[model samples]
Target: MYVAVKGGEKAISQAHKLLAKRRRGDTGLAELSVAQIREQLPLAVDRVMTEGSIHDPELAALAIKQAAGDLVEAIFLLRAYRTTLSRFYVSEAIDTGGMRVERRISATFKDLPGGQVLGSTFDYTHRLLDFRLLAEGDAETSSPTARDSEPEPEPEEEAGPMGRVLQMLEREGLLVPEQDDDQLPADITEVARSYPCDRSARLQSLVRGDEGFLLALAYSTQRGYGRNHPFAGEIRVGEVSLTLIPEELGFPVEIGTLQVTECEMINGFTRLPDGEVKFTRGYGLAFGQSERKSMAMALVDRALQADDYDEERSSPAQQEEFVLSHCDNVEASGFVSHLKLPHYVDFQSELELLRRLQSETDVAQPVEEQA
Candidate 1:
């Protein structure tokens, strides 16, 4: 055991040195700059920003570099950094209705007030790799110039401030009524989470939850466990106006816009507080261009609201405690990784106990067997 422990310590040290060498790659090539990661790998940076719950691109880039491109590690780094910053003031909730849209689409509607704008997407692209990218200096000239081609402008109603589809349903008396705006919502970050949490707190936990875990849960719902037959009422990618009220100013002032991905999903049914059944909505919003994460969040959000529909809550996705408890990657990673730490004293105690039990058993054996 002593030899094994000493060997492990030496092995770990050597492995770390090798890892540092591997991370640095070739000495002939220039080291990758943080700015290059920020600019070239925007999607990856966006994911780090969204999952990390921090908005600074430069810091996210640094975390990405420090973690050697491990997104979860980067998120953990950023989240740790976020805890150290001094709190100044809280920003007001953003209005998605007033969003300056970059891309917007809906699966439920073939044609709406705003025509679908397919901007900067891989949706229709073939998944084939060019192979030309492997050749040095070939990537720059081989890039497609699709941006140079401009299509005709969409209709005024389609291009202009397109209203939310579900809001239209609400006006026409087809959707479930929303909660009163006057009530103060619970803050999950400020308060510790418990089972049967309120909607606001549930959503707060989910926004910082693991995207892959939420996606799996959302996918499970579609496969018939706690199925809600959801429709994408709107999946919007845009910049929303952020405003904050200063104590001295008395009135709210526009701080700056934040890029976000917002999804509004229309559930099949929900029983209202007044015992009336109506179509309900599930909402999700995330930092940066994280459409998939937002959509998954909305699906899981509705699944957690199964009690509202009086639906059978047998599925794992419908259980609030199970979902909320294991959804954080940081918590999961720490717990799993801690198993690698030395447990020599604990194991030694267990070994001694077994030896004592064996000795007692030998002494209790028959004299005939000893002969």
Candidate 2:
């Protein structure tokens, strides 16, 4: 006997209640606080901030807690919240050269003027597990250092803006000279409305994009789709000034600053216009610490800028519009998930065709006998 199953609403309600209970598990332990998560789980916070397009560690921590530690869901939550925010003003381009660098390094050059500072990184740490930390009051905790032991340096007054490293290469005739243009660069918003082409805007979109999607696209390039040997010229993470120009004020105002990651990739190329061999550069920047993504983005950026590189077309990665437009995860997810909806009519049509084919095949009769 077949019976129609109902109570979908009841089942959904129960599931919600169960989820709530699971999220707030075990009353014995102290509940996870937003501040604690923000401070302790800073890497997670950085990922959320990078993908969320909003740089609030507290909010990201709250979203992470609310989403039950599902990083992707937390990103979605942050993105949704960002949509409700009103845009009061647009900030001027940040001077990254003047950043108060916490960590900076270059793969292209061993020594630079600022010098490489390997701040906090797990690169040198061993992967061995330490069971001592599992027990309460295990080993003697390290004593706190004196406040004046490493006093914070006062902010510099006359720090001259340094030109980009690639600019120096161009001057030395090692890199392809950047074409000079008298025309002013078009505004990003206006270009987005018509056709998105600005590298800054494209990079901004990729910064908040899904890590899985970005990683996959980057992986594809390495797997012979658009293979290009890339060298990380520089990778920097630090705080930069945010200056805003209010329409009414007609003067730049200093807004709150933010920490960001910037990457410059040098790629091999031979210029076509002059038939000269010179290095080409790709750029990537993102909010917070995301060196991997930024580096990958820079590689793809250079590949798409192949025309600018004067390299002969060979791969899909060289197609700027195709690569940039289809790399978004949200759009891909929606299109894929939409297939799960009820398509009774289409299913019925497919079923009829399959049945007809089966019936014709089932009728086993010799050709000679039939004739």
Candidate 3:
């Protein structure tokens, strides 16, 4: 057990200095800029932004840089920074149907209205390291590949927003749709904790939850834990305009364009009171191009809705308290990281108890031998 000590202000300060030095290793090498991280490590920045519950890429990159690329630390930094900002008007629910889609695909359909758009993805690429990238990383040591070596492909035809896959099912009355209420949606960030949280609150929590945690839970559902005959309805990644209507202006105004990934899962159908069966939807949305996170979120969403569908809720994914309470990386990190702090007193107490038990055992053994 480590012994607790006091009077180390100078030592603490020196340790911080040492930490900074280590974070900036090898003085001879060029330092990385926040811009470089924001542009090059875009997926990392996107993850930070999504789980951080903040949409600013520049700030996320800055936090990543300051935290020495520790993403959980970066997420924590972003959340703390968000507390200082003033509350503005809440934007209206984004109309993703009209998204300027860059990538659109449907697993259920071989060919949809928009056609399968294979945008920038690593899905087809072999898991092999290009030595050229290893040799000339950001330095660009080699000459550029000649355009003349390969035939130029024909450009894609101009098209407006692609059609939604769910619309097809909805048209046939095969999929039940979410009822839209006129009331303002719940502000999950400001709302106080309460039992039996609304669907809005649950969704808000899930979106901000850790990607890895959600992925694991989603995988568990597929492995028969919370089995829902799930089919990926659609997955889309694109930029959408954020719009808000002010009380005074009485008209909607475009606020900002945000990159987002959305996934929809068509789960096993349930027979209603009218004796008609309709497929259920598990919706997932994430900031930036986070297809995996969105898909996982969708699966977990369906699992969590087991009660609503009159299905047994015995799975870990279906347990709202377990999933919501522990999915946050920032919270999980804080709980685990606290172990690094001085726990000498607690350990000493444990050691004392162990010693007492051992002494009692020793005394009992001697008496029993005498008997």
Q: Score residue 195 of candidate 3 by CA lDDT.
A: 51
Candidate 2 segments exceeding 4 Å error: 1-7, 130-163, 177-201, 220-224, 310-313, 343-349, 364-371
Indicate the residue-level lDDT of 56 in model 1: 81
Candidate 1: lDDT of 28? 100
Comparing 2 and 3 by TM-score, which wins?
A: 3
- Give residue 85's error in model 3 in angstroms: 0.9
lDDT of 1 by residue, 1-371 (tens): 22135557888899999977887789899999999988878778888898788888889898898888999999999999989998777888788888888888888876778777766677887999978777766775444454766854655566556788888888887787565677667776677897798888889888889999999999999998888889998999888998999888989999889889999999897667787668877888898888889999999999998887777899989999999989989888988887777778887989999999988878888675578
What lDDT score belongs to each candidate, Candidate 1 first?
0.85, 0.74, 0.87
lDDT of 3 by residue, 1-371 (tens): 34567898999999999989999989999999999999988998999999999999999999999899989899999999999999777888898998988788888987667566767777888989767776655565454353635733433432534778888898888987777876665666877546566778788999999999999999999999989889999999999999999888999999889999999999888887678889988999999999999999999998988778788889999988899888999889988887897888888899999999988888879877667
Cα lDDT for residue 184, candidate 1: 69
Model 3 gets an lDDT of: 0.87
Worst 10 residues of 3 by lDDT: 151-160
What's each prediction's TM-score?
A: 0.87, 0.80, 0.90
RMSD of each: 4.2, 5.7, 3.7
Which run of 10 residues does model 2 get worst, by summed lDDT? 154-163
Runs of candidate 1 with Cα error greater than 4 angstroms are 1-19, 136-156, 271-275, 354-371
Ranking by TM-score: 3, 1, 2
